[model samples]
Target: MPKKVVAETERRRRRPTRQGTVLSEKLIVQTALRMLREHGSAGLTARRLGAALGADPSTLYRYFAGLDGLTRAIGEELMGRALDSWTPTGTWRADLRSLGLAIHASYLAHPQAALLTASRVTGRPREIEVDETILGILRDAGFDDIDAVGTYHAFIDLALAFAALDAGALAINDDVREADEDMWTSTYAHLPPETHPHITATAHLLADRMNHSAYPAVLDTLLNSAEARLAGREG
Candidate 1:
């Protein structure tokens, strides 16, 4: 009986065992996006990701080349997710608004990934689609082909630059609001009244206008500038 039990145990140990399959590429991206939402850029490393996914660090390389590639994949995933809900309304203004806000919200929601990927020019598939949409919006908004391309060049560049800056600020633990508070309360508190009279006097008002309000206001400013330049060229 003891010999039979020992033989059975050996057979069980030798039998082909199935542990759960390692995570897939899409699964890794999804989990990484979640981790990015919870922790900032410093939290996202291959080792950390591997730990979170219950796999060895090297397992991730089968899916993503490295953290930079992972970051790019995250960016593309963000764009893909954002575009899933985004449909063009045929009106250029509406289309532009949707595209800009969608990209902003998507990146900001994963601020860590945003900080890593926002400034990068991925030229990924979804990014090309985004560029196409921007050009289409410009053309729809009464721009000729040349005007469309030029306006697209300006609009996308400005929007992406702003997105990167804003996301970078927002990613670092309320640094955006905290820094503004410091600037107003601490930095401006001791400045001499005579030489810096303007800032000292108007600092209170400046404080109120710099919140989420800046997004729409900056967008308006960019659109206005682009429109004015188009007018100049046409004139």
Candidate 2:
């Protein structure tokens, strides 16, 4: 290629650089989300992000206070996006299930980001909406204010716990149920023939019970307990 052609190609490839003017806070946060999706949490840093954006590393300060601030922003962005896309039908169980699964699926969609963001409580506008909606559902289902909020708290806690646990399991490259099965097998597969009487004798059945999904039975049990508890209570 000629010198003129080479120069033009380089110019086209160059990044925008107006120092403080070119990099907006919104742009930084937005780019961070995209980076999180592509590179995972550990890959995101101010210096690396600046290079990707073609701005000076120090210029990022105009947008975010630092790395921690950027992480929180990304968390809030993800939650906001998830909740904005949600619309509640009138069915209480259906709505609750939708909310729990939506959040879990969205988080698991980006495993690294999920692990980082799952533990945080942003208390942002979207979070407030979620809380209010949950409490309202419980109240409409015959719970009083205290009971409603208590149920809402339990629901939120369970969703967060499940999401966090799922993320952690995936982070270690383990299938959630499979990991539990392995634990049961490694610990129980070789019980002693003499010393431990009760457990050693039951080893065969224990092996049979291991490696299965306990969610169905456990959830059924929980549902029964909830029904019994609610049955005797006044709304």
Candidate 3:
């Protein structure tokens, strides 16, 4: 065996597919992601995954213990992609904002996967690294342990919550998604001023703004609230 193949074999137990194609964890996760994108959440099954990979369904057990384990692995892959190219700039608030956007974008890229795993706690390597990075940023910015933990919890949960919400919207089929988008302009904007004065008065503004994700604004608010709390502690 080539040294590379030997290393892979040592790193993970492998089995050749029915076509004699070798399999690894990375390949499986990537295949699973593609399946999710092509078929939506319902399309990802061990048997289907096996057929896609040209491997026996039983072969998957050696890699992921079960479907739940595989789901977490997929979630970890998203986390890995989010942080892969990002480097902190030492400004805690700005760094956090960047991180939040990156995470949200990654989840949005695979909305079905995000819908499945956004709120999950994988405890996998990439997920652990992300958690540590957030906590480290807060600690470096002078948050005490308690405040750091609390703020980190709030920050991550808020980001994932928005990711789930936005991804769910995106995951809807095209016609429904378009209709939902159009509702802001068609339905909300055209409400009669006499019966619904408030909505009618601001209908134009609401139509203009209602189509975008509120994650950025919500993230800013959370960061600003944390900053206020930290400043109060110092004074």
Candidate 4:
């Protein structure tokens, strides 16, 4: 069947279930995200999703092509949320910083979803919009095409990479996460200064800071580099 025909047919089939739950792509994605948060990535199977929605597992195919397609939708939803929260200021440095933090915080807020979707390249609407917005910000700030593209690429990759990295830390079981966090204070902070002089010297700082996500600091560094490049170009 033609893709559009299939989509139309699917739309026609949308209806309320016995529980009065209306089935739609948005509902499914939202339900899936909730499941992921409560049960982690491994728990978002079709059967479980259908059970949560009070629908047949097969009914999901009407809205999404398959599990992969549904997963992409989930990814796009997160991106859409991040984009929605941001209002760009004309100041490139502040705008990029705000955007970067919003994206990072959005992912961190849903660590389970971030673990599954942060590394994905959905190439969907929100993802495309974010790319365009970043490029526009850089270009408007006097970056040439090459510079804008390069900066966009780096900025996005850094944001997502840090999201995935931090989400991994957050998505671990509570007990495991506590153990990991405790290790900074218990193990690293108590290492022998004779052999681990550098670590011992800064153990207090490390104990204070290591448990936190480094995304904010790293973001500032990247933005600084981009600003320097732009300044050099104008000079």
Instruction: Tell me the number of clashing residue pairs for each predicted model.
Output: 0, 0, 0, 0
Candidate 1, superposed: residue stretches over 4 Å from native: 1-22, 174-179, 185-192, 211-213, 228-235
Local accuracy by lDDT, each model: 0.71, 0.65, 0.88, 0.88
Task: Specify the highest-lDDT model's number.
Answer: 3
For candidate 3, the lDDT comes to 0.88
The residue-level lDDT of candidate 2 at 166 comes to: 64
Candidate 1, lDDT over the whole model? 0.71
User: What TM-score do all the candidates reach, one by one?
Assistant: 0.76, 0.66, 0.93, 0.94
lDDT of 3 by residue, 1-235 (tens): 1122234466454556676767888999999999999998799998999999987676677677677778999999999999995778999999999998999899999999999999899989999999999999999999999999999999999889999999999899989999998998889888888899999988888878787999999999999999999999999
**Residue range 1-235, candidate 4, lDDT tens digits:** 2123156344644568767877778889999999999999899998999899888887777777778888998989988899999998799999999999999988888999998888899988888998899999999899999999998889999999999999998888889999999998899988999999999999999989988888889889999999999999999
lDDT of model number 4 = 0.88
lDDT of 2: 0.65
| lDDT for position 23 in model 4 | 77
Residue 58: error of model 4 in Å? 0.9
State candidate 3's TM-score. 0.93
